[model samples]
Target chain A: MIEIKDLHKSYKMGSNSLHVLKGINFNVEDGELVAIMGSSGSGKSTLLNILGMLDEADSGTYVLDGIPIKNLNETKAANYRNKFLGFIFQSFNLINYKTALENVALPLYYQKMPRKQRQEKAMKYLEQVGLKEWSHHLPSELSGGQKQRVAIARAMVAEPKVLLADELTGALDSKTSYEVMELIQNINDQGNTILVVTHEPDIAQMCKRIVHLKDGVIVKDEKVKQVRAKVNV
Target chain B: MFNRDRWKEILEVLTTNWFRTVLTAFGVFWGILILIILLSAGKGLENGIRADFGDIATNTMFMWTRSTTKAHMGLPIGRNFNYKTEDVETLWEKFPQLRFISPRNQLGGFGGNNNVIRGLKTGAYNVYGDYPEIIQQEPMAITAGRFINQSDIENKRKVAVIGLGVKNELYEAGEEILGSYIKIQGVNFLVVGTYKKRSGNGNGEEGQKEIYVPFTSFSQAFNRGNNVGWMAITAKDEFPITSLKMGIVNEMKRVHKIHPEDTRAIGFFDLYEEFNRVESLFGAMSFIGYFVGILVLLSGIIGVSNIMLIVVKERTKEIGIRRALGEDPWSIRKQILLESIFLTIISGMAGIVVGALFIYGVNALLDANGPVDMFMNPSVNLGVVSAALFILIISGLLAGFIPAQSAIKVRPIDALRTE
Candidate 1:
């Protein structure tokens, strides 16, 4: 579950202040699959960054699982991010030097898991992503689709309550994009709370709910029939 | 801190850039080597010079009579003087601190023409008349037979201890010279021993060219009266030889009736003072060696610091990623610090091992060859090695500190945006 009310964010460019997120109110209930859709300058990316706690909002009252996420120190904020949220970046963001298995194990390492258990847990997640055979390969050696799958496995390995996908298929071809979307659909079917941020209408149609933003404000919120990803290719 | 994974990561990073690491460590390596070598070489020089003075015991003094500069009692200012045999007894009675005093008389070379000798062969050579106590002051190795004893002095026996060089000149090599009579100045004296000086200048061979005989025989045979050419004196262990030397100088001035202010009258040489001067000079030299060594090592440490700074800069992206993964700032700092410590220890230890081997080679070479003037076995001191290890640790910490601080300051957002 996630709750946000009157969230505000701004950036200073030279002497001018650019308002990125303005007076936004939004909520997502438990186990819901949602898409936040917006074109460039619609503040969708800014909202995702705020939700991921990677950036501080100027003014916000955000609650996740009944805990207020405000005025937390760096350690507390990092702990919360580790325990409750996961991120899938458009660029995959896998450390180039580490193998896919090691990348998946990284979050568990931060959690202070023992090496043997961490390795086993990381392998299970790689298996779930259908990448068990390719777990030892580095990101550079992996295809775009495989790298994104590894990143998704990494995001899921920590067992966080909410998964945030930020244009996860932006760098892939349409067929690979559909395959990744199919994976996301399967994950949502297992009752995980997820938010997909994208500008693509077809990507939005794959989610059970969609929220549209225009000029730093949400313009539409509606539920839709989810389309299954055809994996014929 | 004891995690194996942390060490693994550090090893990976270092091995990735091993060539650069070695280049960075070279300055420090060379610094440690040069420091240890210079210090050991300086010690070797001091050891060699001290070896030359070993025959002259630390607690000994040599007093030879010189002309008085001022009138005292009935003696005139330029009055030439020679000590008599009675003067030795008188000096020993005057100074109870006197441990062993030998009234020495010499013939040939030092005062006049060398005596012509006849034995297995014939040659001219210097001869010395000394009491048995002279052996305690400046020792010579007796090769064959024995030195002149107390009975030789009491009976005024014509017994001689010929030097090795004298033996070589007057007799065939490996021939039996002991108990064979050698005629000196037409007086036949039985060869009692053959001797060689242990250490000295102008080559130790010079001392091996002389001969030793009992004082009474030398005085009686040469018709030199009761005159003593010079005296060698040593004090007991508990006494300060310098004070005794000054007392003797004053006493000699009183007996010879020379002015107390006339320093040249007695012509005394206090070996203890000379030894001290040489010791202090070596002390100062070692101090300078360490001072210069530290300066060189400091520059090497700075070089390490500069390289570490570059390494930190290059890893900004990796550091950011770690930060984003919930890694603590201290962990980043620790990683960088450990890498630096590893580099310093590895390189510094290599230098020490190489330096020790080099010193070993030098010492072996010196041992195989004879001791050279002002130099002997060169080797590193244990204290110097301990000091070098301490310096290495401090250098490691000093080099790592700034770079570690820079590494921990990386924010995830800015680092992620770097690409």
Candidate 2:
């Protein structure tokens, strides 16, 4: 669950400041799958970044699971991010030196889990993504869809309260994108709260709710008619 | 302390870029190797030079009379002079600080030869008529009997202490030669002892060719008169014997009636000053060894630092991922620092091992060949080597510092943004 009130963010470019996000307000409830949609410079990514706690909103009240995420120290913020949020980047940022299983186990390692149990739990998540057979494979060795799957496994392995995916299927083929969305949909059905950031209408429709942004402000919020991903062979 | 996962990570990172690792390590390897070798070689050089002054007490001063180069007080230039037995007594009374003062008289005075004979066996030797104190100055490893004693000098006894070489030449192996008679210059003298010089100036055989007789007996029998060829005096610990030599020389000038300003009137050889000179020479050599070693080590550590900088740059993404995964800045810093230190220590250890092996090889060669010119028994003290390793560890940490700071300063957002 997340809440924001009058969030603002700006970027300084030499002599001028670009107001990226201005007076944005949004919310997502428990177990709700939401998609935030906007074109380039529309501030959807900025809003998502603020929600991910990777960037601070200049003037806003952000509440995630009843804790006001404001002005936390670096250490406390990192701990909160580790405990409460999982992130999936467009590029599927799996450390190239580590195998898929090791990548999935990384967050658990920071959690101070014993190496053996971490690997076991990572293997379980890998199996959940249908990637148990490729656990030992490197990210470079995997296809685009499989890499995204590995990233998804890594994201959910820690079982964080919120999952934030920024353009999760942006680099995949349409068919592979459908499969990744189906996996995300399945994860959301298991009662995990998820937010997908995408500009694609079909991907936005796959979520239970869609929030549209323009000029750094939310323009529309509506319950979406869920379109299930057709699982191809 | 041994974490298998951390070790696996380090090994993977290092092995993935094996070429760069070895290249980086070479700097430290060569540095430590040269450091050890230079130190060991310096030790060898010191030992070799020290051997040249073997058995001669460092505090001993050899004073001999020479021709006067400048005349004063009615003494003409080019006047030859010699110290006598009475002067030795006078010197003793004047300077009681002279612990062992002995006037040495060789065959025909100085630079003379005397052939020793026992039955059909004969060996040529440089004979010395010396006091019992001579044994203290140039220690002899007595093999058979006693040396020249007070009674022999007082009574002018015809007793001789033959050298080991003389004993070997004249007597059969295991022969009872002590108390036996030996003929020197056709004069029969009873062999009171057989001795060998404990050390030599790179020539053990030469030391073995010497023989000692009572000074009184030598002066009386060889008609040496009252003329002493040279005087050797070893002072009681009040040293920098150069001042003592000057005092004695000035005293001799007053007693012997030579000119005070005549520099060439006495051949003053200060063993303490000579030893000091040699010591300072070796000190300079050691300083140079350390100076050059530090410079090389500096460059090597700099190489390590440079490589660590590049490594940090290359791993920015991985570091960002770790940060995003909730790793602290301190953890990132520690990781980079550990890697740098590991590289230095492993490579440095290898260098030390190889350097030790090389030194061992040199020592083996030296042993096989006996004492060589300008080099002997190259070795490094364990404490020094251990201290060197300790210094290397600190260097490793220092080399890692800047790179680790760079790693710590990497912003998670900026690094993640880097596609």
Candidate 3:
């Protein structure tokens, strides 16, 4: 569902330029669960950003779902991001003022969906994430695991072609982290293509394939023995 | 355009800092209130001043003869001359623009010794000899009997129109005044009419104490021999008497053989010129009111703009999230602008309501008491209110412009990166 060839990106910091990504090639088929692993400043997050259409690469040939991504204006890029990609952030970036259900319905609101249908669809997603009873609660009132679930529900409600999770469980405790991982695994089992970006080896192990990055270049690409997350609830 | 979600979002964001929002709104509220109050107060002053002119024709001037300052045609300097009855006909023939020219003669000056004796009720008063047209120039209501008409002047009838004050002084209360005889300086004349002058410039009492008699009978009785005391002349509506003053004076100077440069030969009071001055004063007052009111309103708009900028800055993260969720840039900009406009319009309407209430209260208080001098019926008309509303809408747009620009300029990635 995604393709990238010879991707390169650089950032200008006053006089000196930092090359974040240099000549990287990657591909993912439909329904594959991939983990991009790297230490700090390895450009793994940068790759996820380009894949999610949040940031453009300085030089690349990238295609998603048979559509090439190049030189799109802000409006078109936003539409593509909404229709083709979902994102889960480490901070559980739920709008603090909106209830969990409203937050999940926001993407559909931008799509100009009718309000009644949007609410119903958002409720269905919230139920899938096991947060039906908590949909009326705001993010501030939810625990770390529940907030992450709300964010996941929001990301999944639009049924994007791929999910891009950037250190999704980094801010949570280990027990909560496993719970979120189990949720992600369950979502991946339903044949949704997903990309997880993390430095944690245990988190990388939960995926079916791993791509390792070192100093703006891929060091290893290997299939992994998938480890299912065990959760109490 | 009419989205409930958008409205809900605006309400939520604005109420987040409700105290600051209220304080920001007060600026616009106070500005509109001050503007309306200033305009209405100016109108009130104009109304009060205009009322002082009363029913007297504003386009009229009163000219009287004075001692000449220069000698000409064998006439000595400082020779006092009187206008003749034939001079009135000359003026009418010379100036077709002149509407009415009434030559008047008076006897027994305003504080003169008891000039009229009537059944042991003697009093000092001023008596005037006037034609029928003089009533049109210096208007008064004929209360009891008829004013002097053409028949009285043509036949030289010895008849008089007594004022209300004259009636009160000469006759007892509830006594018949019309068709009665009052002897003026040993001449027995019949009182035919009674009048009341409308109150003007604190002179209503003095005006009602005067009396009018036919010009022919007065000249005959007083042995004035075609001599005119002073003339009250009114010009046509299209002509201004002030502009025609010098021409009339010069013509009179020529007729009486006085020097052309004898400025003191004929003294005059131009009511039209004075009325014009008062009109320009009103215009200046209104101009000043608008100038100061707009300055205050401009400061208020600036305050609103400043608050909007702060609001956009505070909601940076929220804007970023909305943008990332495929909210178009125009939609984000529209939300900020909508919020700003809503606040401005609400505050402006409140100001208008409060100003109207204030004017109503002031009018009620004035009604309960009596009219105040130089201020009456303070109010703003519908046009002014509509103009204020238009200004509020434009100010809302201006106040929102910069902040809305800043909001749309935010890149979703950088915004999402911000805490």
Candidate 4:
């Protein structure tokens, strides 16, 4: 479902070029739950942003669902983000002015969904995330766990081909974090491709597979066994 | 988010930040207020000056002989030329533009000292004979009875209209002297109507201390042999009073068989020149008032721009978040732009409504009291309101466009990363 070949990103800080992402090659198939784990400065967040179409790689070949992502312009890339991509951020990234329901329905704005149907779809996704009762509350009015839940709901509402969770449970307590992971695992089981970036070993263990990155390169790839492995498989 | 949704967002921004919004609105509100008030005052002053000229048609040109030191046709320098009735008729006959050029024959104290009214009235009155057409050329809208009619002139009747000052001395009230009899110079004459004296007034020249009698009657009764009264000539309105006076002077020379160099023999007051001078003064005053109003309004608009710049700066983080949420640059631009337009419109409407109400209150008061006694009907002009409203809308758009475009240029990544 995704491919990256010779991807490169550089920054010019005053005098010289600092290459952040060296040329690399990677791939992940459909219905796969892949976790990319690395220490700080490993470019895990930058890779997730590039995959989610939020930022551009300086030199790279990125193919997503058979579409070559590099040749797409800004407007087209934004359109692709609307139709095939969704994001879950560490800080939630929900608009503070909006209620949880409206925040979740935001992606539907790009699809031109009429307001009533958008709200209904947003409500269903909030229910799926077990936050149906808190769907009308603003981000500021919600606790850390509730805010992440709403963000998860927003990510799931569009039913995109790929869900990129960037430190989705980083801001939650362990109990709430476990609850959120279980919800994400359930979402993966429902047949959507999932990618998560995290620094925690336990968080990586929750996924079916883990790719270890070091210094912007993939150092190791391993298949993991979960506590409730294949329970419903 | 075009109209309804855009406005909804604007209302949220405004209601959530009411104090900031009101501060912005105040600038526009006061601007419109000053504009409307100054304009209304300008209109009032203009009307007052016009009324100062009074109801007697000052625009009518007179060809009364001005006494001169020079003589014509080699006559002695000290000799005076009298404009006779024959000369007045011959001049009028030749010039078709002479609407009414009749000799102003007076029957001063013709009723014998006005003692007929006993000691109730003073002897400060005169019975002046005028052609029936003379009053029509003037601005006197008769309050009750008609002016001197052709029949009164042909029959030399003793009927007359009393001045407001004469009415005060005789009948002592309004709309009542239409039937009262007044003894002018000891002769009993019926008052056909009472002329309204222009308000806040003094001096008899403005239709006070006088009575109007038919020129034909007064001429027969009081004009002696070879007695040619002053020529009370009025030009047709289509003709300039100056040109008409010149035309009449040329024709009078032809009739009197005098040379063109005898310009000193004739004297006249050109009311058109007087009207232009006064009108130009009023025009300058109106222009200055508008100039000041616009200057203040421009400052107010600049103030609005300053405050909006501050608002954009204060909301940088909020704007960055909105931009990153997949909202287009246009949406950001539109949101801030709508906020500004809403602020300006709200404040402008408030100012205009309040200022209009104030002016309306004054107009009502003035109407109840009557048009400016010296100036007629100095009230609010709907034209001025329309002009002001147009300026307000243009100012609204002008003051909002630049700051909002600046908002659109703010990069989301830069804004979000700004510590």
Highest TM-score scorer? 3
Q: Give the per-residue lDDT of model 2 (tens digit) for A1-233.
A: 79899999999999999999989888889999999998988998888888877789899799999999999776777788888889998889899989999999988988878999999999999999999999999999999999999999988989999999999999999999999999999999999999999999999999999999999888999997899986331
Predictions: Cα RMSD each: 5.1, 4.8, 3.9, 5.0
List per-prediction Cα lDDT, in the order shown: 0.85, 0.87, 0.91, 0.74
Q: Decide which is better by lDDT, 2 or 3.
A: 3
lDDT of 3 at B189: 93
Q: Best DockQ goes to which candidate?
A: 3
TM-score quality measure for candidate 2:
0.81
- TM-score, predicted candidate 4 vs. hidden true structure: 0.80
- Per-model TM-score on C-alpha atoms: 0.78, 0.81, 0.85, 0.80
What fraction of the real A-B contacts shows up in model 2?
0.49
The per-residue C-alpha lDDT of model 1 at residue B217 equals 96
CAPRI quality of model 3:
medium
Show pairs that collide, candidate 3. none
Per-residue error (Å), model 3, residue B350: 2.8
lDDT of 3 by residue, A41-155 (tens): 9999889888877789999799998999999887888888788888898888889999999999998988889999999999999999999999999899999999999989989
Q: How would you order the candidates by TM-score, starting with the best?
A: 3, 2, 4, 1
lDDT per residue, candidate 4, B150-244, as tens digits? Answer: 89977878788767666666664543667667665556777787565554445535456677887766666554444555776666768766776
Q: Where does candidate 1 chain A have its weakest 10-residue lDDT segment? A: A72-81
- Give the C-alpha miss distance for residue A62 in model 3, angstroms: 4.3
Per-residue lDDT value at B415 in model 3: 80
Choose 1 or 3, whichever is better by DockQ. Answer: 3
Error of 3 at B287 (Å): 3.8
If ranked by lDDT, best first, what sequence of candidates would result?
3, 2, 1, 4
